[model samples]
Target: MLLRRGILWLTLCLPLYGETVAGRWHAAVKTPSGEEAYFDLEVNHSGGEWQGMLINGRDRNVSSAGSFDGRKLRLEFNYWDGRLEADFENGELRGAFTRQSRKQVLARPFRARRTPLVSPASAPSVDAGGEWILDVGEGGGKEMWLASFEQDGARLQGVLIPVSGDYGMHTGFVDGNRILLTHFDGIRATILDARISDGRLVGTLKGSVSAMVTGRRPDKAGRQELNSSSLTTMKNPREAFRFSYPDLEGRVVSSTDARFRGKAVVVSISGSWCPNCHDEAVVLRMLYDRYHAKGLEIVALGFEYTGEKERDLRQLRLFAEKYKLPYPVLLAGTTENAQQTLGQLRNFRVYPTTLFIGKDGLVRRIHAGFEGPSTGARYAALQQEMTQWVESLLAE
Candidate 1:
């Protein structure tokens, strides 16, 4: 009788001791404003190893690795320095998603439940083809987003282009009139849930934040225009851009330092907290590797979200180490004080505003914002243009 009781207990607790969180989980993250953003996560165990993939819209990002020790589960999304730590109970996962590189350890509440994969034969079919203009937000804070979608049977693919930047490629499936799409780029995850009614797309946009979205095909509309010029007014253009800030080691570095003198410099106004800045950093690293010996010098002035200097510097150090950046990243100020910190420039609009200075120390161009990889051809074109411009500067 005692042996039988012990055997029964072991059998009952076996799943708790093992990786029971394997398989598909339907997740919904609640935004601070009480809106819910949904996603699908597929976890697998093979050869004594655990793997996880986050499926949003249509983008699938495989986790670098994951671990499940009974009740506690941890997943790492290496591409964006993100982590999900949670607890499993009654087939439900509840925890937080964090950007591990940040100093403050900001976390968003995340929850998921086990779900079975729907068979293709039983899946609902809908067509999601054509261009759409999405009106996002409400009241006086509305914004417009342009989207292009293509569908084949149940498979759906599309891109959402917002004024700030594109949301990359999203892939998912359409079941009847209800449509779900998602995109995850390491640092951020976006989910769109909508239904087709009267040939209009009505949905909820859930990403870094949540918003109600309504989209429609226009009778006649051209591609949205982008502001092309980078030159911003400065109180004095002839005067060299100047600043003195400490690096991660508390070493005060000045713009007028000998290392930057006579070099065609790229001064990047960036932040460790910005995803667009991350994309720009990758490009800058490539440019530095290619042109550093040819008189190019890149310096980043970081205006971090964390106001605490020590924490902010720690975040910057992590960012630098992660990307293996070769340039100096100096502490400028917090995001709130950015306008004042970079007061010398006229109308500095974004986190990744860049200033190109010729060897003569005159500001040549001030490119505001970045058109990341999601823009596809636009990103390639920008790379070509910047490379040519850098080459010209080197020759001069």
Candidate 2:
């Protein structure tokens, strides 16, 4: 009789349990400078499990694997092994977003409230909705960025494009003369707090790395900086490109394998943490599927942040699984050791540097980086250009 009563009581409270995690969240992580880097999430409880999504500028990456056992919640951002765990407390959820490697566990304090209303700013003092130049770092460490923005009323959406690639999108609001933008995509977070003085935008970029950033209107000379696609090249262009690395199963896959002989091949140098590399993977899979039967092949040499073999392989596998890639992705080395990993390559300035090798086994074309869909024309142009490149190589 007592057991029956407990079962009936639990059934009555099931709807209340569902209400605990069924709303949108405004999540924040504390940066090193003590500023909150923000992102949004929307979670739903269905089929007796909790599913959520990490909301970035133009991406809603869904967490298909997670659980909520009444009071505790865990969400897995499996695309890159980003995880979030929290507990219900005082009408809010408190937790830590974490990433793991064999050597360390990196965690950041996290807290979230309900998604709040979007209020327009009092008065917009400047239109941050066009092309500009953002310079980050100083001296040899400096990189020039192409800032493209879109403004509607007081809300602002923008992206910073560098010669290497873009950092995706940043969304914020313009209040008076100051503009604040924040982004948290599970693995990394960024807070851009800047104010307009005269005609220049000056601010500090805070997150994993802190630096002062400056922006200005670009002149004709500054516009020429974007033409950098052909700069990276091989130390010996006449020599055929070759590499040997281990796949996930410890099988050494080499460029000189019989399978690639007399066939057009594409070699991709990418990393686990690179957003641009992730974008390039999708197009690669489509091309492989379309032309694999017509003597075309592709391979990705993954250089990762962590040097531990297990952790790096896991990330590489997850990246491959996300795009359902059929090609062999091999572990090359840590990002810092890329020069040693690819001895013949020079001027490697980006995470994703694609090499187009003709049937003669010599690399004929190289693209420095890839910009995703958010960059509009550049993204479309790369896809079209590469498709034609692949066709020409196969034709040869």
Candidate 3:
């Protein structure tokens, strides 16, 4: 009876011994460009299990698992290819956000503190909305983000559309001239803090890297055509789209294989280390499931950063398994190797350039980059466009 009582006492005391990391944490990381990025994390417990949810822009990714080992807090986001390890003390967390790849591990310093919710009630003086253009970097290194914001009093929700893809959905509140937006998706965390002055928005894009940002309300011009097929082109149109590479199990697969012959195939040139590639994979999976019986097949040609075959294969396997990809993901070799193997193509500039081939095995369309779900109407439009294109091809 005494031992049972002691066990109960110990169990009760455990909670008092450690600082609970529950609730909301405002986190920041310094990027290589000497900029600061920020995000918010909400930690909770349910059914005796601890988990977390990451909010970045409009994207919400739930944590696979999270645990606190008295002194250290560890959160695992398996699908996003990264994890966070931190030391909890004095009501603050200090550690690093590590992005894992087969070739290297990139880590950025991370720190967070418990903070009150940034809600509409707390921010009562903000009045800004509509579409804006976010110009990041400068000169040849410049990139633009088409942002659409919907503001209801102090509450704000919006999406940032970039060339590679959109930053999903972002939510936050505005405080006077200062507006704060954040998104966290297990693997990637982004925070935007901007100030409106003289009808111009100035802020910073913070995450693994930080960059200065400036924005202004767009003119009467429509949304820019950020994605174009001309971004990646073929050097020789007559050359039959062909490739022979080994799958995860070392079985040689080729464009002429029986599984793909006489079918509409999409050759996705991608890399495991790329977030954009992950987005493309998600869309490809949905398309394959919807049209596979209609003579549709997708072959993902992974152009891994790591030149080592074994390591690259491992990464591809992880990617395929995580997404439960039904189609074959062949290692077409490293990024440099892709240039040589796909010699018929010129100036391959993107990680997820998609090549659509008709039933005749001739390349029909090449889509460079991906818009993803963050682009709102553009994402839906692209989906509709691709679906219609596929249906047309199948009918022919």
Candidate 4:
């Protein structure tokens, strides 16, 4: 009887063991490679329920699917397929946190505390302003990356662009001659660190993995810019874009459908696991709302990481429902087999390859990758530029 009473008392005490995790926390994941990523976490507990948000710059990702057993806490992202499982002890939340992407199953050691880390107050030693041409190492797959920075005093804001896509907006600072920048949306986290060495900047982009990258200021004596429009091209530009796929409901949707016959169409080739694609989706929503009634038709070709049709559809449905997308999204295929599945395009490298089609049913322009809101001014300009393209096609 005495032993049973002790066991029952221990169970009862477990419920009261965890302290209230209801405050702003400074959270970070230190990967096995010693690289680190941080994000602002705001948690609230009310009515015996716990919820929170993972904040990265201007994005606030909601975590509503949660459970707290007093000692252990598990919170799932509202839109993405990522979760945080932590134990409350020593006045800190410590556990393994996965990347927000459904394809990302690797969990890293995540720790959070009430206090935030302080940034260095020293002034920058160098001005990291203007466009840079990066020559990535062989391990990264991509040969080049275009990066632009806006620096104000010691603070730095920028976006890293690859041939296929971009690492969303980054917020960081220049410590002496070193540049540090980071971006953590609900989907992924990318940290950049570079140092000036002999009129050149060299660094490594690190997250769950690391890749060496070296860059230099644009030489006016050569190609000053990387044209994203020229990256992915149709094997035969004279032919129109064509595809037939099923949506979440399993109904076939074809490019030849009468609904799109006479309309100026925008085809977004993207994946559910891609963060930059999410950024592009937000802008697509705005453009669809404005020009949808003006003879503009938009469709999304979803290529997911997992080939499982049912699970991919679930994620796609959540993405559409969360954004309240007015257009149809078709599951084309798996991301790994995209090049083979989308046989018409050969140089396909990125998640979000946007193709604009005129009323005549021909692809007018194919813009590879997207500049999301975190890109600041570039994002604003992209909206105007895309709108103008649509307007011109509609006018025809």
**Best candidate, lDDT-wise?**
2
Per-residue C-alpha lDDT of model 1 across residues 158-184, encoded as one tens digit per residue: 777665456667766687887777655
How would you order the candidates by lDDT, starting with the best?
Answer: 2, 4, 3, 1
On TM-score, who's better, 1 or 2? 2
Model 2: which residue pairs collide?
Answer: none
Per-model TM-score on C-alpha atoms: 0.78, 0.89, 0.83, 0.86
Per-residue lDDT of candidate 3, residues 290-389 (tens digit): 9999899999999886688777787788889879999999999888667787788887776788898888888888887777777677788877878887
Write one digit per residue (lDDT tens) for candidate 2, span 216-316.
Answer: 98776423356446768888989999999999789999988999999999999998778789989999998999999998999999998779888889889
Quantify how close model 1 is to the true structure by its C-alpha RMSD in Å.
4.5
Candidate 3 has a TM-score of 0.83
TM-score of 1: 0.78
Alpha-carbon lDDT of model 2: 0.81
lDDT of 4 by residue, 9-30 (tens): 9866754644466678888777
lDDT of each: 0.75, 0.81, 0.77, 0.79
lDDT-wise, the better of 1 and 3 is: 3
* Candidate 3 colliding pairs, count: 14
Q: Candidate 1 lDDT (Cα, whole model)? A: 0.75
For candidate 4, give the lDDT. 0.79
**Model 3: residues with Cα > 4 Å off, grouped in runs:** 1-12, 15-19, 33-35, 46-49, 101-103, 116-127, 171-214, 221-224, 336-341
